[model samples]
Target: VLRLYHAKNVYYRIMRQNVLLLERKPEIPPSKRAHTGKVAVGESNQRWCFDGFEFSCDNGEKLRVTFTLDCCDREAIDWAASTGGYDNSTVQDVMLRSVEKRFGDRLPDTPVQWLTDNGSAYTAHETRKFARELNLEPCTTAVSSPQSNGMAERFVKTMKEYYIAFMPKPEVRTALRNLAAAFTHHNENHPHS
Candidate 1:
């Protein structure tokens, strides 16, 4: 028994050494951690956060999902899914729909700060123009830091846990339909903690 324990310890020590040797250090130094800035605190409709998440269908087709959330109430303002890929157009469509649904035809008297990551779509010239036209102040999170937009990130995680995880893997169309219904229920009925 003593010999067996010694052999096991030696094996584990060698494996630990190998893992340490194989580990690659991060490009950014520990002291240079990404800063996400302060969380927004205001009335409903004043600040909104948005982000994108991706999942794969059973057939291996990728689906991109974008979601916007009201920071005040923690309500999901709007969301969109595209198999074709989320681009500047998709971002515009989602933002426009959200604004129209919440504020109707007329633009808001005060500019709404729409917070998002430094994604290509959010940073695009066309998207910036559209936001300006609709009285939206595009607020971007610090580069490489998603925690700055914690509300949107939490919503995405909740969505996957409550809806997407239980979905039938083989049916993309059905999953999408279910997702729409789930989103509505989540936004309208689900209470935030």
Candidate 2:
């Protein structure tokens, strides 16, 4: 096994050297913006970050879960699961649910800033229009910079660690049920200290 491993490493090294000698370096595009560091949340519900997380079930089916987090309290404001893929319609649904959860049926007089990554669904024109109608100021993080939307990213990581990672993998439905329970637990019971 050791001899085979050494032989494989040497072969890959030689192949990499040959490839590098023959291929020219590709040009890279300049980043759209610089890193602006963490976003400060002045108060609860002032700014919300939304993102999509993907998980796989035991049977190899994939599910995309969309969720919104309140920046000030790190609470899971709202979430939705879909096996049909996330698009403008799903994004709109999550936003509407979040708005309703916060302000009931009436829209807030002050628009809340909705921070998210530059996903196609979030960037779609219809989604933008709907957000405006709901009194939300849609804001996208810098291109190629997930850290700009770190709060949501962090919550996704925590969810995977504490909940999704331990879920039984037999069925996507079971995973979804567990995920919903985990989200509720994190929002209502998990301490943020």
lDDT of each: 0.81, 0.85
TM-score of 1: 0.78
Q: Residue-wise lDDT of candidate 1 within 1-193, one digit each (tens)?
A: 9999999999888989888545667687432322336555568888888899988777887778997888888877888998887999999998998898889999988988888888999989999899999998888876767787887887888878877787765657866887888788887887564
**How many clashing residue pairs, candidate 1?**
0
TM-score of each: 0.78, 0.80
| Global CA lDDT computed for model 2 | 0.85
Candidate 1 wrong stretches, greater than 4 Å: 1-36
Error of 1 at 108 (Å): 0.7
Model 2 — which ten-residue stretch has the worst lDDT?
31-40
Task: Report the CA-based lDDT of candidate 1 relative to the real structure.
Answer: 0.81
